[model samples]
Target: MAERVVPEGQRRRRRPTKQGAVLSERLIIDTALRLVTQHGADALSVRRLGTALGADPSSLYRYFRNTDDLLLRLADEFIGLAQEGFTPSGDWRADLRDMGLRIHGVYVENPQVALLAAHRTTGRAHETAAVEKILGILRGAGFPDPTAVRLYHAFVDQALAFAALDAAAQALPTPAREADEEVWLSSYGRLPPDTHPNVAATFPLLAADMRDSGYPFALDLMLEAAEARLRG
Candidate 1:
């Protein structure tokens, strides 16, 4: 690579790929996303990243110091995507429900990114904006400042918690995930009534419903309870 002039005091790294494609921070994140989506989160490594980029692994060091840095950036990007098209209509329940769905939907689509963000707070611009929006909605719906903040915390955490659960289900390899449901159908569903009356009695319902990850049901339950609190 030629001695390219990079701007001073900027952390953005730029270089050319083997196919003469320009690489930047966004390109790196985008490529890393593909790697994670296709091969699972553990597949992300400097050596593997270079192969995907058609450049030496050392080149990635110019941008991300390590894998955590890369994961954080990707998670932040997911936050951006999660809140896309999320507009509050002033009806707190409906509006917040839609926002929750959007958040969970993105997590399902990008399980690897969701895993990275499951425990850590990125404190990035996108995450900050999402918090502000949720708090504003709660306050606008007649919640006192303290109550709004508390409810906002619970609401967002509930969505994220369920998202992480659903994403974990999705992250499982196809055969492994299928086998789980098979256990429910074949083993749990076939338990003898003598020792496991409840399991035998409810086996049909369990087999019919156990296939879902239950994020939607969980989201609605939390939101309904929150609404009841507001009414109370």
Candidate 2:
């Protein structure tokens, strides 16, 4: 007897599990996200997800090819959440600022997801839409094709990079996170001016500023540079 082979571009029929739950792609993605959020990204395996959804582990293949494939879908979903309800105000700087903040905020809210998927290229619908929107905004603001592409690349990379960095901090255990935050005050702020002049001088400002995510400040600098390029 020969084993069965499913064709490409088609899925096997989905059936209810022993627990009487009918699983779909959306359900699977949602469950996976919840699992990642609750148990960390390492818990996003098929067996765990199956247990969470009360479906057999093999049933997930009907929707996703593998864990990697599911991860891409999850990444795209994060992009979707960030872009949801976003409408451009036609001011290029303001639009970009809003979008950048949106991405940062969403990633911070879902720290585990951001830590795992922020660096991935999903190449899916939500990601495609975000790319198109950014390019359109840049081109509409009088940036030439090459310049637009360059700025687009820089803008996205900056957003994701900072998001991942901040998310990593956010994902840290409470005690570790608190200890890290205390470093500026406990160590850097108390530096001797004679030996560490710059540190001593900047300690006041650093103490006030280091408590927050630096994404917004970095984002503003990037936008300012882009504005300058547009002016030239």
Candidate 3:
């Protein structure tokens, strides 16, 4: 029997073709991402996605077991973007800040997706890879494994929390933001000056603060606290 040789192009084509019944998981994930970005996580369903994709709903079952599985994959896709774009330089502060801002950028870019993925845990490959990379970066900066993991989790949690909260605050209707002001004016404005001296004294300064100022200030405070703890 003669040996068989397959051309590079043919081999590549055949490889994909061989995945007969298996759906394009990547395509499905990308479609899911767009759907979540445009509508929201609640807008996603197997049937709806199939209708949007022009495939039978059952066809998605070949790739994902259920909507939860699909959601997990979507989370992976979001984290994967961060991992792909992040480059670790030797400077830990610069590197960590870049990483935090990158996570913020991704969530801010896709608010709906951020809403769904922020608090959920998806023990997927890309998510684990992201975690490992963060740990590696911190450890490379001379932090012990326990310290690195502690800071890594805190950094990630705070970034995502701020991202979600920031999105929600921005998405509030005009009436809602206005209503918040009404409460501030009616309730806090009426506080007895003698009883609440500090509140009255700083009322102007407090009122001067906006959501834009508050979220980043809080996130920076959290980061600073973490650094102090690590230093001690």
Q: Indicate which candidate wins on lDDT.
A: 2
Tens-digit lDDT track for model 1 on 1-232?
2333344346454557885767677777888999888888776888788888887877776677688778877877887898888777779888888988888889988887677676668788888998888888888888889889888888788888988988888888889989876998779977899999998998898888888767778778877887887889
Candidate achieving higher TM-score, 1 or 2: 2
Candidate 2: list runs displaced more than 4 Å: 1-15
> Candidate 2 has what TM-score?
0.93
Provide TM-scores for the models: 0.87, 0.93, 0.75
What lDDT tens digits, residue by residue, belong to model 2 across residues 1-232? 1223235346444677667766677788989999999889889898999899898777777677788888999999999999999999999999999999998889999999999999999999999999999999999999999999999999999999999999999999999999999998999977899999998988889888989988899999999999998999
What clash pairs does model 1 have? none
Q: What is the lDDT of residue 140 in candidate 3?
A: 86
Measured by TM-score, the strongest candidate is: 2
Q: Write the number of the candidate with greater lDDT, choosing between 1 and 3.
A: 1
Whole-model lDDT values for every prediction: 0.80, 0.89, 0.72
Between candidates 2 and 3, the TM-score winner: 2
RMSD of each: 3.5, 3.0, 7.5
Q: Give the alpha carbon lDDT tens digit for every residue of 67-161 in model 3.
A: 87778778787787776767788877777777777777677777788788878789888888878877878888778888888888888988888
| Candidates in descending TM-score order | 2, 1, 3
Flag regions of model 3 displaced more than 4 Å.
1-23, 177-192, 213-215, 229-232
Candidate 1, poorest ten consecutive residues by summed lDDT: 1-10
